[model samples]
Target: METAEFPAATSATDGWEPTLAAALLGAERAPPAPPGPLADLVAEADPGAALLARLAAEGALHRAGTGLGPEALAPTEPRDAFGPECPPAAATRLYGLLSEGYSARGRVEEWFALAAASGVRPPAWLFQALMLHRDSLPATAPAVVGAELDWLARACGEAPAREAAADGAEAADWAEGSVAERRAAFAAFRARDPEGARAALEPVFRKEKADIREALVHALATGLSPADEPFLEACLDDRAGGVRLAAQHLLPNLAGSRYAARMAARARAALTIESKRRLLGGTTHSLVVTLPEESPELARDGVEVNTWERRGGGARASLLRSILGRAPLEAFAEHPPRLWIELALRSEWADPVFHGLFSAAKRTLDPAWSEAMADITAEAYEGKVTGVRRTNEVLGMWAEALDLLPDAAWEARVGALIRARKIEVVLAVLAQGPEHFSEPFTATLLDWLAFVTRGSDALRRDLAKPWVIARLGDRLFPSEDAAAAAAAILARLPEEDTDRLRTQLTGLTGVLDLRAAIRRDFRSETTTGGMAQG
Candidate 1:
């Protein structure tokens, strides 16, 4: 099943070792992240399979400890000696953090660092809280998932949102509670009675401040439906710019929104599919483009005439793309994404059209559009296409489309990128991230990286480009096993030529090692020890 594109990874073409390195990638995972204390993990199994064993053992221990009677288990004294419990302040911090959303994810990672620094495992209740408040987990940031709760999300193909402690807040909480309490209350109420929630929110909507209004408006997404579009449309005129932006973003997703209808009108006026008679006697279809003039209506709907300026100057296409991007696919194109791509590629409007549909695909999450957009973006990166700039914005569009693609598609696209040795391209993709990279892909990516890092000229990226070499660790699996494998790079660097690179690599690897060490502490059966002050 492995592709031959990564020969440098499997064969010893560069006079480097490949046996231990083989375990470094393409398995279910890289080996268990073994830090100094658990350094022996490297000796126990191949790098790719060790993490599986670690998780299996942990799962068994978790079940046995939580389910079985205390008398049936091994004495806690031995377990306690090896692992220390997370300290009080850190434990409380984790409890507090669980309720926070993507905004506070950084703090959660810091909590892990502190707990790890203190050589302790996070409290068991923290795991429960994390799973309970799992909504806060970013669909990106795969590395920050410390607790093994991903399975719950994976099983459903989407993370299941467990209601918070305040999911059932009384009317008082919704009507007069603090902003925090109201968020949970409103979201919970919205999920069951969308209309009722709208009615309640609408009456007091004007009274809430700009920030509170913004937050409450975002909560509307929980029960988002076409019926909410009218309210959202009204929000487009709110005094706050952020609220206007939020509403502008949400409206396109509503299948029946007039916003989509208006955008569709603009699209029809701007672009048309015209038929032309060929010289040889056949007929051909052409996508003709004419950008719209700016107006108050366009501005009210959130279109900026200067999208071109912000996007580095493509005035006509930029304006047309704004219209096309906001309109739903059913209204915008008679053809499918692939055919539209064919037409787009032939026209000067390629990048804008492609980007516009990419935006639309993000809103709709249409698999067909996502697939075509992903392929086109990859091909652009591979230089098979032109006009689509090789910018992070384009890569971001690629990543967003990727979030909607199937796992198999993810493997195929990323596998090709790695095979081509598109280092920064791969890094950018991984940096923007997906829900999670499957085990085989994670293994393959890290394995290829490890293979390249050793003294091979084919692995030249680690030697020449700081963006490729230095930042490599940041986008990697935040585990001891992953870092330990990467640590091999340091041994191969020439002391004179790679001093700066060596320093950068050291810092990246150091962070991974610390994360791995923290994971090791968590893996041990925690018993009474010096509580982590973190």
Candidate 2:
């Protein structure tokens, strides 16, 4: 073979392929037309030179990718498979999930679970593309793609090489790789040894530009702890606002960090809970809100004060709440979380005050505070609380907190909303996501759906019903059961109303039907429990 220089030529990274036979045969036997971008540049060239140019074009085809991209360093034969590709129906659905039905991203997981249960693999035509895009799929995707993927996995350089690279070798990639690569390497280092990652990062840390520095600092969150406090506290003084913000996020989760300690002290000093003897007899408690004095120094702790970057709330109020939000839940050791919950409902700064506790509870996973806030938020929604005005914003705060509650608490709060027909509040339980829904959690959801899909007050009237249904599709278990429920509900609707509502609930009923079809089409002899029953 011969080569030529064609630096000006280009190839479509995805669409182009080599015409190897013409290139290898030489200009005597088979003259080749110039290919890809070379078409215009080499069109007038004599055949031999054109073939040589095609050979040179090969160099540009080599690409830079995650070690997961497909390549082959040696001659090899395709592996033998134990079973055929998934059923035609299953393959068609997988293609849809990856393409058109991409909006319902949650269903991707269900697709894989069904594939795994069916003991089938992706068809050959889609195999290479699936291998290339495996990162976007569930971790189980490779296994679902089956043992046939072993050679491709090796071709991508992801065997021992990928494993070995994840260790100390990763730190060196900081200088050699792209920002995505650097972040991945730094994350690997952090995962392996956070302290060591910090040490390795600190020496070279300031050398990069601000945006890159911010991303590298974000990698510290992998195994965050008080050990990261000093480093992150130092980062709060960074010139980039994003760097300071990233540091602020990691610090709150480390309650023992100096940042947390300083914030807790400032919060206690600002809002003291005072107990006074009542003139009649008993004692009463009141929250004395002495807001903090804001200044430029507050920026060192990620609290914006005098700068143009000060938050929406006034400097003093913002400072107080920022401190309260990051403060450890134990900061107010004297008062039970429930006491603050009730006080917050009646307090003049209800949302602002409770928001701090809610933030702290979520960051720390303090179940006590989460449960209490959820109860009050639901009570306020039920119209049982007279003094406080129940607004969507208030409901939003507790809806988010509901996800953090213990399983029993999560069930109780959601069940309460379902019984009261507070569809809005019930739907708001997806602050984090609709993932992790246990059987009981999904059972509560099904009951709510059964109630709201009937009558004129049905979910059909809610503008967001379809969007909510799509988001909840993967969380609802046992598709056959959900499908049965959905079909029964549709059957119960008046003939005229039935078709219209079904059109609106395409997200709910459609997903259930699709899942049931997948289950039936891909049913395997060895299929067992997990999602197989669905």
* lDDT of candidates 1 onward, in order: 0.63, 0.68
The lDDT, on a scale of 0 to 1, for candidate 1 is 0.63
Q: Write down the RMSD of candidate 1 (Cα, Å).
A: 23.4
Inter-residue clash pairs, candidate 2: none
Counting clashing residue pairs in each candidate, in order, gives: 7, 0
Error of 2 at 204 (Å): 2.8
Cα deviation in Å at residue 136, candidate 2? Answer: 4.1
Models 1 onward score TM values of: 0.59, 0.73
Predicted candidate 2 versus true structure: per-residue lDDT over 233-330, tens digit per residue = 88988888889989988888886777777887887887777789989999888777887776666667777564542545466766776787888988
* lDDT accuracy of residue 240 in candidate 2: 89
Total residue pair clashes for candidate 1: 7
The digit string of per-residue lDDT tens for model 1 on 59-164 reads 4534444443222333322212224666555566567665666655754665556555556655455556766665555443233333234444444354333222
- Which candidate has the top score in TM-score? 2
For candidate 1, give the lDDT of residue 396: 64
